[model samples]
Structure formats: structure tokens, C-alpha cells
Target chain A: LAKTTQPISMDSYEGQEVNITCSHNNIATNDYITWYQQFPSQGPRFIIQGYKTKVTNEVASLFIPADRKSSTLSLPRVSLSDTAVYYCLVGIMDSSYKLIFGSGTRLLVRP
Target chain B: EPEVTQTPSHQVTQMGQEVILRCVPISNHLYFYWYRQILGQKVEFLVSFYNNEISEKSEIFDDQFSVERPDGSNFTLKIRSTKLEDSAMYFCASSEEDISGELFFGEGSRLTVL
Candidate 1:
């Protein structure tokens, strides 16, 4: 299991692009990077995932450099509704060893 | 979009009482997991089940906690004897093979032990 480090919180206005970075210096060769979003009173939701380089979807983009020591999650356009905690996880198959979570970055999308 | 579902959105139990939390994961998912989050704290993994057996568990998953896939679709977490410290939001999640580590979690069952 690779531990990740991210900012405690970030504030952004609606309609702006927000990029949050997570550092995992000990990322393993087989580990995949994934991001999750959690809203108050609800369970965490899958946001996006990637292995290397960059991957994009309708909601966000993930950019991983060659070092694989850090990755960034980019939310194209922010909205008040997007305010939530974002978690970055690094693991491979059978992550059951432990799916530990840390104090994720609380992203506040101000309207 | 299929999703995992949990029953008894909230449960209140007396100390030493037995309690069961229920979950119905996505139909096609093969792996099941249970996690808990105390108030204002990070989520902690409890256990993971597959092939009708526990594949992994955390230290917090003591003897008092057990998971069972009693039927084809229902996965449950049973607490033998509840303690006040057991009060927390319990979440159930599932994923397809390779997991993607992308667990689809349910709304969660808030348990309050008094």
C-alpha cells in the first residue's frame, strides 16, 4: 500500500478549472492511481483513475508524470455542487491488505 | 448506473446488544467490502470478502465483527456485542475484478450505540 499526501483543503470559484495534486513517493510498479469524491452524509464516489501519462473523461483529467511520484486531478469547470473531499489512492489488485484513507483535500467550490 | 445499497440507513442499539448491517452490492460485482468512519474521522477498512470467504481484514475487525454472504445477493456485517465506540457510519462497497480500486460505496448505515 502506498500512502498519499495532498493539501488539506482548496477553495475555488464556480466555473474555474481546479487542479489538486497528490504525492505518492513510494508508488509501486503495479499500483494504479485513483481518485474519489465524498460529499457530506454520503459515501465516497469514484471520480477517475489512471496508470501513467494522462487520462481524461467527461468529468476530470488525471496527469501523471514519468517519475510517478505525484499525480494531479483536474476538474475542468467547478460548481458549488462539486464541493467535497477528494481522496487519492494508490494500489494494485488485491489491495485488501489495507485500503487506508487519510484526511483528504476538502475542495470548496464557491458560487 | 447500478449502485451498492445498504439497509437500515440508521441503527441505534444498546451496549452489549447484537446488531446486523445489511448490504446489497451491484449484481455483477464479485468483491465485497465493509468500512467505517467515526464522526469527523477518516474512513477505515474493516474487511473484504470474496468466494464466500474473508480475503482480508483490518485489526479493527475484531472477533466481535463478522461478515457473511448468506445468500446470493445479500452481504451482511454482524456485531456480536455492540459497544459505544462502535458508533459510526458503516459503508458497504463492491467492485469488479482487478477492483480498479474503484469501490462503489452505498449511502452508509449510521450506527449509534448507547
Candidate 2:
């Protein structure tokens, strides 16, 4: 498992874009970058995942640099309901592999 | 959208008592997992099950913890002896393929051991 480092917390207002970066210096070749969003008293929900370059979905976009040493989760037009904890995980996509979560970045979307 | 479901939204038990938490994974998912989070702490992985057996488990999943898929639709976690330290939110999740796929998680079963 690759250890990830992220900001402890971030603040954003409605309609503004929020970007959270995660650093995984020890990322392996087979590892993929995955992000999850967790609301208060709820389970973590998958947001976006990517191996390299950029991947976008209905909720968020993931940008992986060429070196793959880091990744960023970009949320467009943030809202108060988007306030949650965001986790960045780096690991292999294998059945036996387990997800190791860190403290995660807490995004506080202010009104 | 499909989701995972867990029973006993909250449980209060005495130390040294046994407890069982149940889950119903998405109909098509093949991989199941158990995770726990202490209040104000990071989520911790406990175990993963596939093909009717455990594929991986963390050190926290010691002799006191066990997992079972009693039938086709239900998965369960058993704690033989609860401790005060066991108080936390236990989440059950399932993936369609492997860890690489999206994992749908349940609302979680909050355990309070006294």
C-alpha cells in the first residue's frame, strides 16, 4: 500500500471550485489512484479513479500527472451539501488487496 | 442505484459479550468487506471476503473476529468477546468485481461496548 498525504482541511464557498491534492511518493506501477467522499455518519462513497492522465465523471474529476506521484480531485461549483471528508487511496486492483485509509482531507463547504 | 444494507443500526452491549453484525450486499457484487471507524478517527479495514472465504484481513481482525456468508444473500461478522475498545462504527461494503471497482457501503452498525 502506498501512503498518501493530504491537507487536513479546506474551506470553500458555494459555486467555487475546490481542488484537493494528494501526494503518494511511493506509488507502485500497478497502483491506481482512487478518491472517496464521506459525509457525516455515512460510509465512504467512490468519487473518481484513474491510473494516469485525467478522468471525469458526473461528480468530480481526477488529474494524475505524468509522474503519477500525485493526483488532484477537482470538484466544480461546490455547494454546502458537498461538505465531507475526502480520501485518496493508492493500491492495486486485486481481489486480495485491501483499502488502507488515512486521516483524509475534510472539505468544509460554507454557505 | 444499488446499495449495501446492514442490520442493527446501533447496538449496546457489555464487555465480554458476543455480538453479530449482518449485511446484505448488492445482488451482483462478488466481493465483500468489513471496516470500522472510531469516533473522529480514520476508517480501518478489518477483512475482505470472496468466493465464500476470506481473501485478506488486517491485524485487528484477531481470533475474536470472524466472518461468514451463511447463505447467498447475507454476510455476517461475529465478535466473540467485546471490549470497550470495540466501540466504533462498523461498515459493510461490496464491490462488483475487485478492489479496483467501486465499493458500495452500508450505513454502518454503530457498536457501543461498555
- Among these predicted structures, which one has the highest TM-score? 2
Model 2, residue B44: distance off in Å is 1.1
Pairs with steric clashes in candidate 1: none
DockQ of each: 0.62, 0.59
- Predicted structure with the largest lDDT when compared to the true one: 2
- Compute fnat per model: 0.67, 0.58
Off by over 4 Å in 2: A26-28, A92-96
Candidate 1: deviation at residue B8, Å? 0.9
TM-score of chain B of each: 0.98, 0.98
Compared with the true structure, what per-residue lDDT tens digits does model 2 show for residues B1-114? 888999999999999999999999999899999999999887888988999999889879999999999999999999999999999999999987664746788999999999
State every prediction's TM-score relative to the real structure. 0.91, 0.92
What DockQ score does model 1 reach against the true complex?
Answer: 0.62
lDDT of 1 at B37: 89
